[model samples]
Target: MKKWLIFSILIMFGIFNLNEPVLAEAGAADLTSEAAVLMDTQSGAILFGKNEEVKMYPASLTKIATAIYAIEKGNLDDQVIVSKKVFDIDGTRVYLNPGEQVTLKKLIQGMLINSGNDAAMAIAIHLDGTMEKYSQHVNEFLESEIGVKATHFVNPHGLFDEDHYTTAKDLGIILNYAMKNEDFREIFGTKQMKWDGESWDTTLLSHHRMLKGEIPYPGVTGGKTGFVDQSKQTLATTAENGPLKLTAILLKSEYKKKIYDDTIKLFDYGFSNFKSSQVKKGEVFTSGKRQFTYSADTFLTDPIDEGNRTVDSNGVLNIENREGKVIQTVELKPIIKKKLEVKNTAQKAEQSGVLSLNSIVGGILLLFAVGVLVLNRKQKRNRRYRSR
Candidate 1:
């Protein structure tokens, strides 16, 4: 009777609280896309990912790279004579007629805003001379400049090619790089633009639903959408709320709405769970007698837990979560003091070698100066002897 009375009292106190169960963080994202990635654009940290590294068709997202490449490499004012080859390309187009002329800037705007295949081909052939050469140059540029690994391009227009493929993470990498350019960012985020082409003179409208307001989402900064029979529906979006800037990439989604839904959930997860944080430039961290300072101001978006963060002897700051997975790794500069300097003597040996080289060069220079002085003195004595 006492035990039963105690149980009843515990229930009344709401000790169980089964109706208001707390959801776990890992399972919070309910995504249906085959592959997706959400990243903090400022920090390059992955906020949420599902098969992010898995290789898949990027479709028109390839133009994000092409647009930036052209903006940086081509003279925007130069008139490109429309070639017959542009009309030969497949998929969406701005309907450029052969022998018609258009500015590089206008073609870029049309290509990005309207998903114009002909514009892409025109830019490629005009800038790089050939479609085959354009692919090689762009692939190399993406790998060398943007640091993308799991992507390859066969055509600038992103026509279905078996060899052309990229991952969600790679697309995020390309978008992050492209967004840094003011020119590319302006066109990338543009929803509508007037086109006075010789063949098709109409306003080019963005196909991205969120960017166009077809799908209402707050803080929609820029977006790109693509679909092909082999690639399915692929989307890329960028948004900023307060100090947080996020980029979400969805690939191979069977349902178009699923991509948008997954994007919203990803953004919500990032904004709700993560926050902007910084380890100020020159903030000292002590390990034993040695001290290390962050070389530059680094911004972070992961959940802050100072205790879970560690600095190694090499001056790398590693932040880990409760599950022990590494969330971010930042490079730091080692601040050597009189007492703490000896701890990293082995690492400083390279610097010492450089000093030694400088010392050797200085000694040789001094010897050369002394030789010059001695020669001058000898010459003076010879002249004096001749005078006597």
Candidate 2:
């Protein structure tokens, strides 16, 4: 009876809430897809994963590279003359006829939204002067900036190539890079994009159908869909749900609808089971020993719009190590009427200020000279008065 009483009291204080880690059995539902990953879109932490690092053909998903390349290089207004070879590429297409005219920007939208293989070829050719050079940029970016070794691309479109490959883990890395780029994120998140009244007089009216649903998930923003007989079906989706905005990628899914369903399940699992840490408003993180104080909820003229990230702070980042010790996040802000650059300066003025040693020494010498002259004149006057 006494042991039970003590256990109950400890639980109330949260000293030992359960005295053990809660091992959730990630149900077999997660294993249905050959590869899957759920990640925190902000901090890029993996919440759940299966066969994440396993190598596989990424199919149309390869266009992730193509889309990013187009965003970086091509201007929407730049007219691309349909090359004879681009119109003839053997895959999906916007059905460009040779001698046709289209903007590189619209071609990209078609490439991503319609998964048009020929559009992909057209955009690739337009951006780098040839498909070959654009593909080199993709390879270098994957290995260098994205830090992905398992991912390699042969085409701007994710058409099946004997050499092209990626994994669920590599997709996470790519998304991490993509999320940081405003243009890339915007393209990925767009539900519908319509551009009309240009010289070519065309609009890319993208209807990513699932994004229109109002019932279960109003937060499903936007993402990409990939499929081919060889790659089966692949979907990568993202959403903003309260404090957590997250993403889930599914490869070799059955149909486009299954991509939505599977992605929804993965997101549901992440939101229902896992919760992230919050740094509160007006919270002060202080370490007197280190002479540091980090304050949150600082005032701006307008309330800050947390676009890519969100926070809930009772007031501060209670940063902790593995041992659960508080490592302070130094809160820093400007003081009134002071140059912001001066914040790095020391308080000791003469000891540490901008004036040099010779300047200070010269001032001291001038003061000493004046004092000696005054004393010498007073002594001379007193002797002359006594003699008179």
Candidate 3:
């Protein structure tokens, strides 16, 4: 009997353990780039990073910011005359002649799809009148609109400039922000478009290998490529698999193939290990006596394996990996029901007090009226006795 009982307890323990989630072993990413980051497009969570915050040259990746900025701030339908400065600008060109009239939208397409330095210069000059003002306005737009801190651009084109620099993380943020805009998304993902320039009238093909089907990634939606002597082989790529959308940024790889390879590794790790989880707007979470909920639906990036969520006293929801490291934190709005209940209770108490005071005043007035009637009757009786 004793042995049987011991066996039964062991079996119960095993069943309990089996019911709990089994955490998969964490994956590793080996990359060749000097700085890289893989971010969740929906939740803005960083899944992998190698010196992501370190300052590095962005090369033509600068155009990602430039393209999005122009699309939002400039009128795409407006006709922009190509300026003389566009012809002399260095690096890749769509080969526009001086005084060539092109729509602002066409210039943006040429700049993004073909890495046209001339197109970029034309757009910059057309929108802001000069490169100097364009740089200042674009910088302000990036900081105020997109919330990038460690980036600055002296020129719209990513030509070699000592003052122009951005980081892998910042590039990821910019790409993520840009992808939300419809016009920017359509232009950024174009693999090929017809070019009708004064000097160059042919097809403009994307320089990104994966985007152009040269590398053949499965879910590659958009890409931007950049390189210069100072900033070697920079690349930005966005991909989607089912419900997961990811952005990968790589900077300072010696070889183009190596940067592409690094991007593949980052994507593989992200898609395999992480999954998206949703928090509905009205769903409530409790922390002791407090309850928290979101006003709008939001998504969270969670490990495919075991993870935990904890709500703190301040209504902050912390999502942690299996190792107890916090991967994401969301500030939840406190549910105001409890506060309303307390206020209602206080109001009732105040009303009760007011009613009690009213009752006391009524009783006093009743007794004073009765006393006045009795005194008037006594005075009338005394006057009747005197008359008798």
Best by TM-score: 3
lDDT of 2 at 106: 68
TM-score for model 1?
A: 0.79
Model 1, 1-388: lDDT tens per residue?
A: 9999988888899885655422224543567778888888888887667889998988898899899999988999999998889878889999999888999999998899999999999999999898789989999999999999999998887778999999999999889888888888899899998899876779899999999999998999999999998888999999988888999999888889988988888887777656766678878877667778877888866663332677776778777655566667888778855566675887699889999999999999999999999999999999999999
Residue-by-residue lDDT tens digits, candidate 2, 325-355:
3322323532224355554444455456546
Count of clashes, each model: 0, 10, 0
Candidate 2 stretches with Cα past 4 Å from truth are 1-25, 193-209, 214-216, 255-257, 275-388
Better of 1 and 2 by TM-score: 1
| TM-scores, all models, native as reference | 0.79, 0.63, 0.81
Better of 2 and 3 by lDDT: 3
RMSD of each candidate relative to the true structure: 12.5, 10.6, 7.3
Ten-residue segment with the worst summed lDDT in candidate 3? Answer: 20-29
Lowest-sum lDDT 10-residue window in model 2? 301-310
Which of the two candidates, 1 or 3, achieves a greater TM-score against the reference? 3
Cα displacement (Å) at residue 40, model 2: 1.4
lDDT of 3 by residue, 1-388 (tens): 9998987898877853644432222223357789988889888887777888998889899999999999999999999998999868888988999998999999999999999999999999998998889999999999999999999999998898778888888888899999999999899899999887778889999999999999988999999999899998999999999999999999999999999998898888788778987789988878778788886788898888877888977778888877787767888999876335788899999999999999999999999999999999999999999999
List per-prediction Cα lDDT, in the order shown: 0.85, 0.66, 0.88
Cα displacement (angstroms), candidate 3, residue 116, comes to 0.4
Best-to-worst ranking by lDDT: 3, 1, 2
